[model samples]
Target: MKKLVLWMVMAPVTGLCLSFMYSPSAVNHPSSKTGKLIISFRNSVDALPLELNKTYINSLQEPFKVTRLKYYISHIELDNTSAVITPDANYFLVNEEAPVSKTITVPFPAGSYHRITFLLGVDSLRNVSGAQSGALDPLNGMFWTWNSGYIMAKLEGRSPASSLPLQQFEFHIGGFQGRDNVLKKISLAFPGGKPFVLKAGKTLTIDINANIQKWFQGPRSISIATHPSCTTPGSLAKQIADNYAEMFSIVSVTD
Candidate 1:
């Protein structure tokens, strides 16, 4: 009994000594290396890049034009074993028509990243916290005045499949509370099909596939004619958001 007790008491001390001897103060003395990450968004199908102002056939065989496609992305995190890279400017609003808004550059700690994760919309806290600026600003025309919340995504255009006035269809999706919350967390592993190693001062550009056809696929096929718009919180909004959850895919990654 005494021998066993003595071993147990000494085990912790031995571990502590070993840890101190083998482990350097790595956290305090982090590697002074950082890199720039470039992210791009595009709408494509069948691996073919999409052309705006052009009508395309969905899985439902309905013709539609994507005049505008904008969405919010926030809280980007690059997964790492030793450290995570999260830039100070994490919120972004991506607009398809605006060439400049389609991509963003962020600074990150130099390291090997295994996966990339990001949020599709503002969190519950930000929604309830009142007005904000930058990507989450109300002047962006993505806010819902009646309910008071930022619109996570917007899909507006004309469609021959619609019976609505002028054959117009507008989808403004946003809800950051309760069961109808539209916030989506997406995780991408080696978005370039391999591990990304960031050099000390290099930049890596990645093409993101923002497939719009996915909006018509999911538990059910979405009809542009009947369901012209989904601007409120309910089953339709949830369903539409679910369809858009898989909108992002990695097209190319260049270091």
Candidate 2:
């Protein structure tokens, strides 16, 4: 009877000690206070599903088919937390072909954030910095050879506008310098500038829809037939980049 009571009493103490040893409170306790941010990318036309290789006409009745659409969004930051989640954890290569690539996550310290900001393209620093892995990896096919920089966005498809042999168009836009600086830093505020609280162990989700219509109907309407690929940095690339400036919009946010 005495031994039974002793074993029971010591068992509780032993379990308590093991719990502390296995928990994160012993190491980087701050990580325990962090939550997750999920950003979703969708290809759509006026909120409808976008079909690849299917002919979709523009305002001018020009028929086009989007065989490929890929882009990069980097250097994301959220306001209201002392802890920082930098580009490496935030940059993403959004590809329409890869359904799993549509969502990107950022781990941040749990707190109330009033604003969120991110770059539309990979910054100049990262492009010339040298080879990287993960989303920025060259094997992903977003990087450009010879020019020694990333192709911020690539749009490949066919259009009746193309009188060429293949009736195809390609736009590989990427530049971080003056005149050709296509990188756009966009800041979005929560509804009514309200702050959204990130609770520990909870994830916050935001939907970002890339409107294809805006690509064909922005400040300057694009005609793939008249204007072909933008393989290099120049005015043509800039013009195409300008049109895509309105490509992204925050559709919804859910906790």
- Best candidate, TM-score: 2
Q: What's the CA RMSD of model 1 in angstroms?
A: 11.1
The per-candidate count of clashes, in order, stands at: 0, 1
TM-score of 1: 0.82
Best by lDDT: 1
Model 1: per-residue Cα lDDT at residue 141: 85
lDDT scores of the candidates, listed in order: 0.79, 0.79
- Residue 236, candidate 1: alpha-carbon lDDT: 86
**Candidate 1 structure quality by residue, lDDT tens digits, 108-139:** 77877767778888777778778787777788
